[model samples]
Target: MADFNLSLFDTSPFFLTGIPGLESAHIWISIPFSMFYIISLLGNFTILFVVSKEQTLHKPMYMLLCMLALTDIGLPTSVVPKALCIFWFNLTSITVGGCLTQMFFLYIFSGMQSAILMAMAFDRYVAICNPLRYTTILTNARIAKLALVGLLRALLIVLPMPLLLSRHPFCANRIIPNTYCNHIGITKISCVDTTVNRMYALVAVLVFVGIDLTIIAGSYILIIRALFRISSKQTHQKALNTCTAHIFVMLMFYPPFVFSTLTYRFGQGIAPQIHIMLANFYFVAPPMLNPIIYGVKTKEIRDKVFKYSCRM
Candidate 1:
């Protein structure tokens, strides 16, 4: 029970305690992160504000888009600010509670983003696969209900991640040297065993990322099948057009999602800096890209953006 001995855990596991090797490379990463943070905020905020201003965009699809923009806006904003401070400003000290708080929001936004995207996919599936029911199915009341449920669902999925981390005791010498405290990173600081926390981590990743991906794939499978059976080129073209933005978004979300999970599981200590950089990008890239991908590819949004630009 040496681990229980106070001196043995003066900090946490030697490897997991705090990042070692404070060095110069962090500065290089910080500049890009700072610039990207601004871009993500402006991009997501513009989508949210412009969509809100246009009465025409108050429909289900746009409502979901706005909700998505809000979620996207927060995801990176939660992680990158602290990361930048650590990299550039040298703010290395974080409280145990503060670390858990950061982790909670980070996971919250990530889960919410996936949930919203799955909702959007369901929206498209209805639009293309069952056009007649699209109106009745995605009414404003239902959309509102879905948003509330999405918030609650995200809360439920992410709840265990931070709660599990909080239960782990942080011995003194709390110097998490990275930009922000990640969920697993904070858990690593515990002086004791955490099989329960690790199981929760795996379960959270599977449920939110895993199940969301499965549903998205299923939605598209049905959509593609319906497209093939349709006879008219014009109708097919229109249906295909609606999918363009959604497909673009899925492409952006999954790469970072898969890579981050793998790197976290297998890449620790082997290449800590590269892994840290990937973790940073995982949180930052999706929010920044979502607005750009959806706005440019979506015709209605493009028009609304133009109208908003003109009004401004």
Candidate 2:
């Protein structure tokens, strides 16, 4: 229509203005970001390595942990390097195609992480609620299917984003006010109507992440109820103990996500700096903390980590 006639997007580069209000401190900011990246990479890798190599850890729970580790690694990898380039080297010009690519994988990994957490909740539910049927119910084939479905679900849901945005005519203003490219951040610069883009993103979050969180909540509620009915206090304590790591991880994962999403939509009172910082932390905290949470709260991972470390 008139929108397309007025503006057309060329294959030019999109400039990223790293952290809206923190440009003056980008060098200093890169220091902490670098440290987080290293810690997250190392920590998630260690978890993946320990889980894969340790024969004792070859169960449904540990398999799910490995999936979490992979997702943890994936999301950071998608954004951090480009962010570091922007922060440290002042290389902020990313092609439209490249920006969209990062946006796609960033969302995909994030969605998968949420799905993996839901699967982990299911793993715990079966383990605690139906102990005898755990193995029979969650066979290797089923676990594989769950993982595949999670990956595909994320891919399918996020697939329309870049394609939808690509058709839009972008104005001359290509500066994305964040550390890296994001769906809303990128789409906001377009001269054309991005109502579809915004609505789709909202629906995707509500349908995908919303449903995953609801399932996780329902599983935990059932878990708590089952724990309460157990006759033996020791047995109840043990069951609760097993879920502590996952609970810690879930706490670390969901809060920042929810807060960032709220800030993007309804938080007009919040400062741009704070909102941008929260978005950055949403990508950083989960990956960095998940392995540590598992290692500290779960004895087996702790012992295995140390066992491998001592030998090396």
lDDT of 1 by residue, 35-70 (tens): 777888888888888777878878999888888888
Residue-level lDDT for 16 in candidate 1:
22
User: Number of the top candidate by TM-score?
Assistant: 2
Q: lDDT winner among the candidates?
A: 2
lDDT of each: 0.76, 0.87
Model 1 accuracy (lDDT, Cα)? 0.76
Scored against the true structure, residue 107 in model 1 reaches a CA lDDT of 79
Give the CA lDDT, 0 to 100, for residue 112 in model 2: 92
Spell out the clash pairs found in candidate 1. 83-179
The worst-scoring run of ten residues by lDDT in candidate 1 lies at 9-18
